[model samples]
Target: MPTLSQQLLAKEAKYGASNYKPLDVMLCRGEGVWVWDLDGKRYLDCLSAYSAVNQGHCHPRILAALTEQASRLTLTSRAFHNDQLGLFYEELCTLTRSTRALPMNSGAEAVETALKVARKWAYQVKGVPADQAEIIVCDGNFHGRTLSVVSFSTDEPSRHGFGPFTSGFRIIPYGDADALEAAITRNTAAFLVEPIQGEAGVIIPPAGYLARARALCTEHDVLLILDEIQTGLGRTGALLAEEHEGIEADLTLIGKALSGGFYPVSAVLSHDAAMGVLKPGEHGSTFGGNPLACAVSRMALKVLVEEGMIENSARMGRRLQDGLAAIQTGVVREVRGRGLMIAIELDPAAGGARRFCEHLRDQGILCKETHTNTLRVTPPLVIDTDTVDWALDRFSRVLSAA
Candidate 1:
């Protein structure tokens, strides 16, 4: 008979869509920055569910809020007001320093909501003609998996066979303010970009790229939308990655850690000029701002600020980056990232990143490969220096062997 892991894999392959190529190991439980497989093998988590578990897995505070709220109330559609929504709004708006917020269920939904708000603002506020407003996006951006979001992606895999794609989006090379300025016109509405491009192999843009983008957007009268879903809420040391550059975006999209992975809670936050155009009955989600999500998110935000997790993330990230840089392995071509969002790009001529990832998994460190040959390391914010050193030990061995 097959073991539980094998059985689960077989069942999934037989019953579900084969859309993912996950690592062979199966995680049964998680805490902080560690996970245990079904066979009882423990590993340090380096990916943190694509930065969703920044507060750590199953955090006691977030869990407490989730359980308490689950017992009290869960869903109450937007038709009537829920007691928790106002508190949620206050906490998120205050934390992010935004004038208004529109809650949604996923990062993709939040991105979509931002797009709609920008379009509406372009028409009503910016005095752009209807259906003529254009949004500029970068080449190596990964906003979300939604149809509209994917349409602007430069990756062939993401765009192939998924079109006829959505229109009104102009693509430009990232880190080039000139491209962005050239792409903008009288009908330009917004420029959407990811701070670090997590899915694109933790690609950090040139220094001052964001400041230039912000300046260009302001000059062009275009909204600057920063997709911080994968890099927000202390993942990159600061509360949001945008803080690293000391620039503010016209619109911000946050999710993943907003609920500490307890539930799907995402929000589109913007200044009054951008968000005010959204009126009642224009958009909503059945479970977007429910009592349960609101209560849990409120607690999650509290823990993130009060616990000093962002400071910890910064310290640990520096230690991890320094340690990885010390590894003089021939296989490593480059080591780059900001805060906990790090990446090790292997020599392309050597092979795919999966081999190294598999070896790391066997040595009790769990991480994921991205963009063919880049190994992404994004552990939970709660991870300490000792845990990071332990994972680095295993990583050192694996990279040395490779």
Candidate 2:
């Protein structure tokens, strides 16, 4: 007979969709920056559910907020107001320094919502011809997996068999400010891009790239939409990755960690002119601003700040990155990132990142590979110096051996 883990794996292969190629470990519980498998073996979760658990797994305060508000009120839809909606709106806007916010359940919904908002803002505010507004996007962007989102995707695997593509989107080279300048037109309503290309192997742009992009967008009278779904809420050590360049996005889409992994919550933070274009009947989500989501998100944002997680991310990030840089350099091609979001591009002679990830998993460090040769290491923002040191040791050993 197969072992329990093997049996469970077989069951999943039989019943589940083959969409996700997750590692073989079967997680049963999580807390702080750690998780336990079915056999009670613990592993430090370096993935953090694609940076969705930045506050750490199952935080007590967020859990309390979730359960309490869940008992009181979960969904009121948009037909009537729930008590938590206004408070959620105020606190989110204040933290993000945005004029208005439109809530949605997931990052994709927010991306879709922002796209709609930009098109409408173009037609109404920018006076672009109806249905003719074009949005410029980067080549390697990973905003979401929606039909329209995949329309402009450069990843062939994601776009395979998923089109009849959406029009009105122009793809430009990432980190090339000149490309952005050349792509702009009066019909270009917005420049939708990620501050740092997270899913493209933690690919950060050249120095001053984003600042120049921001200036170009402003000069061209275009809205700058920063998809911060993977980079916001202290994942990049700052409150938002755009802070690294000292620029503000006209519309910032955030999700993932908005609820500390307790619930799905996302929003589009927009300027007054952009968000003002959305009238009542124009757009809505049934569970977008529900009371439970609002309450949990409020506390999630609270603990992330009050607990000094953002500060910790910056400090630990420097230590971790420096340590990784000091590792055995033969097998490593490059080590680059900001804050807790990091990646290691392995040299081709060392085989592939998948084997290194499997090796690290055996050492009780649960990391994931973003590409065939790139290992993405993003731990929870709540990670401490000691934990960073521990993770660095495992990474050094695994990559050195490779």
Candidate 3:
């Protein structure tokens, strides 16, 4: 008889939608920054599930929390209060230094929650008339796969045919504070932005752009909402990426590494005036604050703060950036990143990014391509210097040939 893994693979091939063009490998187990495929091959994970596993996969602390909570109780539907939800809120609020939190199940949901909160605050607090509240977004931003999120996306594939979309969003060129100011209006309720555009090939705004954006939002009485789902929780060497700019947003969306990939856990965190607008039953999810996910997220937060992972991310991220920059390859156009979220934008005429990614996979480095020609290299924060050097050597070899 074929093994269970083989049977599962067959089933997936036969029934699943081919929406994802993943690397031709099936992983069965992961630890720290490495994953083992079904055939006993090991690969250094460079994507980290788009920074969702910055704490690394199956982290012992989070795994124990999940197991312990699963043994006790998994779900209570948010119809009744759970001990872990309050604890999760306390831990996250303490870590983020925010006053209120609205838990959700995914990054998109958290972003949607923030949008709703911002619009409500606009009408209820800022006195913008109903349906006139507009949100400003950036050109190369990626929030999530929700309708409202795609409504502001400048990416054609993410927006095409996904609408007739939601309204009340305006787009401006990223890093251009002048464009931001031009886009703002009295009816502008919020400025929704990703501090560093992650899926837009790890594009970092020009220095002082975030600070200027914060000033503009405050100046215009608009809420500054940062979608930090891909950049938060030490992925960019900070609990929140905005901290690097010494600016604070009125609302922040976080997910991904919030639960260390154990489960889908996201939250909309904000100050009292912004989040206070969310009255009871205005927004919620059945599994948003479930005990199991909350317990796991609590442990994940502890590991991020206490285990010195953020420092490691900063250190290793520099090593990675320097090493990739040092690679003498003509195909490499530029290396840009903050913390562990790095990207290598190749010359666009060099064929697509997928071929290079497939080559890296063959070299036992599991990385992925993004946009059209940028290769995003985000590994787990637990990676050590030796493994990084090894990965660099392999990357250098691959790019040299390309």
Across residues 269-333, which tens digit of lDDT does each residue of candidate 1 receive? 89988888877888989999999999989998999999999999899999999899899799899
Provide TM-scores for the models: 0.99, 0.98, 0.97
The lDDT per prediction is 0.91, 0.93, 0.91
Task: Score residue 275 of candidate 1 by CA lDDT.
Answer: 86
Residue-wise C-alpha lDDT for candidate 3, range 31-111, written one tens digit per residue: 999999888989999999988999998899999999999999999987899889898888889888999998899999999
Ranking by lDDT: 2, 3, 1
Q: Please write out the lDDT profile of model 2 over residues 1-402, one tens digit for every residue.
A: 888889989999999999999887999899999999999999999999999999999999999999899889999898999899999999999998999999999999999999999999999988999999999999999988999999999999999998799999999999999999999999999999998899999999999999999999899889999999999999999999999999999999999999999999999999889999988799999999999999999999999899999889999988998899999759898999999889888887788888888999999999888768999989999888889889989988887776
Worst 10 residues of 2 by lDDT: 393-402
Q: Tell me which of candidates 1 and 2 scores higher on lDDT.
A: 2
For model 2, the superposed segments whose C-alpha errors exceed 4 Å read none
RMSD of 3: 1.5
